[model samples]
Each structure stands twice: as C-alpha cells, then as structure tokens.
Target: MSSRLALPPWLRVAAAMFAVGWGANQFAAMLLVYRDEDGFSSEAVTGLFGAYALGLIPALLVFGPISDRVGRRRVMRPVLVLSIAATVVLVVGGHSLAVLLVGRLMAGVASGAAFAPGSAWIKELSADRPGGTGARRAALALSAGFGSGPLVAGAVAQWLPAPTLLPYVPHLVLMALVVPIAWHAPEPAAPAADTSRHGHEVWRVLRGRPFVLGILLTAPWVFGAASTSFATIPTFVDVDVAPVAVTGALCGLTLWTGAFVQPFGKRLGDARLIIAAGLLAATCGLLLGVVVARTDLAWLLPLVAVLLGTAYGLVLVGGLTAIELMAHRDDLATLNAVFYSLTYIGFAAPLLSTLALRAVSPTALMAIGAAVALLTIPAALASRVSPRR
Candidate 1:
C-alpha cells in the first residue's frame, strides 16, 4: 500500500491560512509611502518596518517550538485573531507612525507564528508521500502566499477608488475565512511521546555548529533579497515614478519573477548550484541597477526588476533546501527561527542604506547593495561544508 494519502483537506486549509497570515508583510510595504507622505524622517520609516521584526523575535523564540510540542492547529487560531486586530488597527490608525509600528509588529508576530508550524505541518502532511513532496508543497505555498501579498496590496492601492482603505479590506475578509478553517484543520499526529519542557530548546539547538552556520549563512541571502524587495527599490520607485504603480510594479515583478522562474531554476538539481545561480543573478541585477543609475536610463528598469526578482526567487528556494539538508530534523524549526531572526536584522540594513543615500547617490547605494548580495555566495559556501569521514 502507498504510504501516501491525499493532500489532506486540513493541510490544504492550513497552508492557505499560513499564506494569508504571511501576506501581511506585503501590506507593510505601504507604510514606506505613508511615512514619506506624512513627512516623517528616514529614521521614522526604519522604525515602522522594524516593529514587524521585533514582534517576530519573541514569537519565533517562544511560540515556534511550542507548536512542535503542542499541535500546530491549536497555535494558528489565536494568530489569526491577532492578525485581524492588526489589520483593523492599520485601517483605523494609519495616520500615526506609532500606530503603523504597532500594526507592523502584530503582523510580524503572525508571520513568525505561522512559519515553522506551517512548514512542519506541510512536511508532516506529506510524510507518507513520495520523495520530498512536502518540501515542494511548502515551498509553493510560501512563495505563492508571499508573492500574492504585495500584489494584492499594491493592486488595491493602485486601481481601487479608495487606495488606502481598499488594500486591507480584503485582508479582513481573508482573516474571517481563514480563522474557521484553522479551527477545523486536522492534526495527523499526536504530540511526540517525549513531551519534555521546551524551556531551553532554543539554546540546545543553537549550540549545534551546523545550525549556527546555517543561521549565519541565511542572513545575507534572506536579508539581501528582502531588503532589496522591501526597502531599497521601493525607495527608488517612490523617487522616480508615480508612487503606487511604481511600488506595485517593483514588488509584483520581484515576487512574480522569483516564484514563476523556480521550475526552470530547479532543474539545475544541485541545491548549491541553485544558490550560486541566484547569487550571480542578483549580482548582475545589482550591477544593472548601478549602470542605470549612472546612465540615468529609465528604460532599464524592467531588466533590473526581472534580474533581481529571479535572483531572489532562486535564493529563497535554495536557502530552504540547503537548511534542510544541513540541519538535523529535531533542530529544523529552531534553526530556521535563528536564521530568520538574523535575516530580519539584515532586513534593517537597506533602510539604513536608504538613509545613507542622503549623503550618497543611488548609484552608490546600488553598488553597496549589490556587493552585499554578493557576500551571500561565501555564506552559502560555508553552509555547504561537509565533515570529512
């Protein structure tokens, strides 16, 4: 008999819920515009984005492994409740920077809550299936959710009659739909027989060298790509074009290229090779951005967009693959949390880089940004290190 079962209705529901919850990050991008239009300084804009990550730290540290011990479904329902409240806060209190920060923080906590359990849930759902099926599903779900978030937010902002209000209105609708499904999602397995206290699970996992290296390697790849997609290019688009369309296009293209191109990039087979391809793609894209800055070439925008988007997509897929191959199963969620924590820290650099652009040109920023993306190559290498027999 086949060890596999159907995709399982509950898993599908959970994946969808995870995607919707994760989508909040895309909406936070809108805060960048709100900050500038409201005449807030760069530091203020940085604070706005930073709240999302701050919310994640505690959740990732506390909630992630707890779900591993408790059932994932149990943890998800409350997160949705929190997400709905955050969306409501954004809709009502968007004018104030402090309110925006709180909203972003709540959104981040939702994301942190969703990621590990969602990933693990997808894996468990596919455990009886053929080779690596769960990973693929998880990857597709994450990419789709992530890619859709910005598109949804951006499209509403661009075409809707009421830009600000419409963007999150759909999110409220999604929240309503997801919460019930989450409540009903099936748990395939009982908690592990060894239901020990999770008190020091984080430190236990962090002590592993491979886990630590994987976390460090992840920073450059995740942060570099995230910073570009979320902060740097958004700043550029806001400067050079109609704020809504340009921001929408940049994020939409970045996400679409990254996701849609994964099938082709995956054919390369070796995870390391895929990571290399992503690094090279981002390097070339960054270089193109620098040249466009130098030549003042408006036409080159599309080319740079495709390059970075594909690069980011490849890096994301590659990072997950590498981490899975490198870490022990028990360490998986903890290691991922550590990696993401560092990755969020790296996310902050672009905002700071944006501030630096006050003294320097965008060309200079592109040069520095591109260089930062390239540094991931070495981190990727380090993560791939194999112990000698």
Candidate 2:
C-alpha cells in the first residue's frame, strides 16, 4: 500500500503530536528515579517536574501564530529535532540539574510547537470524518503518547542497566518513525495577516461566557486531575510492586484510560452534558483521592486512575470541541493555544499539593481540590448558552 493510504492524513499529523507528548511526559514516572537514585532535594525534584511549563507557555503563545501565518507543516517539521535533542541531552546529563532542566525545556518547546499546529492540522484533515472526530483524534494521540512514555520508561528503568539513559531510547525511535509523516503532513498556508491585536483578541475571547464559564472553568482540571491521580496519590501511598514501575503503571493507566474515553466524551458533549459530567467526574476523583490519602489504600489507586482518566479525556475533548464550535477559521490556532495554555495550569497541581502537604493533611488538601472542581461544573454548564459568533 502507498504510504499515504497506509497512514491516513490526520493520523500522520497526530504522529508528531504523539512523539512530542511522549517526550514531554516520559519524565513523570521517572520522578522516582530522580529522587531515589539521583539524590535530588524535594524542591529540585519539583523544579525538574515543573520545568516544562516555563518553556511551554511561551511556545504555545508564539509558535501558534507563526504556524498560522506560515503553515503548520513549516512550524511542526522542526519540533522533532528538538524532541530528539531533548532526549539525547537527558541521556547524557546524568545527575546534573542544569542538563536535566535544559532537556525538559527542550522537550517543552517541541511539545508547544507541535500542539497548536498539530491540533489545527489534524482537525483540518479530519474535517470530513465527523463533528468531534478531530478533537478526539488530537486527544487520543496526545494521551496515548503521554501514557506510553511513562509506561515504557518505568518498566525499563525498573529492570534496565541505566535507568535514566535507556528509558528515553524508545522515544527517539518513535520520533524517527514519525518523521516522514510530520514532514509531509498536508497543511497549506492560509496566509492571514498577522496583526497587533493578539493580546486583545485573547482577552476578548477569554472574557466571553462560553470560554470563561465553559472551558476556562473546566480545562485546567483536566491535567489537574490526571496529575493528582498519578503524581500526588503515589507520593503518599505505598505500592507493593516495584517502585518506579508502579508509578509508571499508574501514570500510564490514567492517561491511557483518558485516551480511550475520548469518543465517550465527544458523545457526552454532543448530548450537551459533557461539561457538567466532566467536571463532576473530576470533583469525585478528587474526593476519592482524599479518601485514599486518608486511608492509604493502594488497592484503590487503579480506580482513582480510571475516574480521573475519564475526566481528563472528557474535559480535553470537550474544551477542543467547544473551541471548534466557537472560534472563527482564522482564530483556530490562537484559540487552541489559549485553551492549551490554560490546561497546563493544571500541571501545577501536583507541585502545589506537594508544597502544601507540609502544613495541611493530604486529605484536606485533596478535599480543597474536590471543592474547586465542584464549583466549576455549574459555570461550565451555564457557558454553553453563549458561544463566540
């Protein structure tokens, strides 16, 4: 079969997004290796975990516009180089903080560059598939990438000779496989005028009830819930399996389950119940975390992963679909960038919860998260009444 026929156009673009996502998240399960084997302090560990966002936010803001003006193919083609560079640095850096940070930052840049363009590209390619097919495709690609990294890395790190170095190899191989597709993915430049009104345009859209009540209120918790499941919960509870392996399994399960649920989320959104359902699931997941934290119940961790995973998938797809329904054609990348930037805010949840654990009990801190999730459901549901014209 021809390469084009073997891999559908949309799936080709999705490959780039997946590879970047794998680079971005492979670090999550390895946090254990960094702490236990590398002898880093808690603050430094948090720094390593949180470093991606510093590079990511600016990339999402800047590269999305560049892609819009130039074309997705132009912008996305170079990110794989950065992704490979990041992994190589990670392999060579060993225990050096500066090297690790640089590696993560490079991965963040690749992900940021890939996400906006990839999201826009896949959606355009999938235009004929179905209403929410694009959103589901994007989410599934990203979630699968995110899940696979930690899953493979955790297992490799547990059994392999060099825990840190060997785990990143598979991602390099994955990226190489997707290079042809990313380079040739079909997105012709639309050539809209770049204007000075970007900040204003972002604010205008952010101010709208549809975004404020619907997406803004719910989007952050997508990552927030996922991070809580794999990152926060594992910190407090003891699992009987191999340490890094268990952590990686939880991380993988959470995101993989999220990936599988994208279609279900799309269905809920089409029924007009997605926002409420997604937020409610997040709230309940947090509440369940509180219970698990209080009881130290390792057995329930998988359940926690499932619930939050479902929430993550639902909120992610819902937010994307919401943007698709509301944004103008020219505004798609910018709006997606904005929505994505918001979601990364939730990436801070695990760090924040860790810092807070010094003073507040884990259960109490998690209850607060549940409360926050509960508060957003109504706002998100109400926002559906008004969409940008």
Report the C-alpha lDDT of model 2 over 1-389, residue by residue, as the tens digit: 26755788888888889988998999988888988888987667777877888888789988987876777888887888888998999999868989999998888888888898789888888878877678779989999999999999999999998997898899989988888767776674455654666557667777887888888778788788888899888777887679889988999999999899887776565523676777788888888888898899888888999989988888888888888777665667888888898888888887788889999998899898889888877787677633445
Which lDDT tens digits does candidate 1 get at residues 24-92?
Answer: 556644654565557777677766766677887778666766776676777777776787888888787
Clashing pairs in 1: none
User: Which candidate has the highest TM-score of all?
Assistant: 2
Cα-based lDDT at residue 18, candidate 1 = 49
Every model's TM-score:
0.85, 0.95
Error (Å) of candidate 2 at residue 323 is 0.7
Model 2 misplacement above 4 A:
188-203, 270-272, 385-389
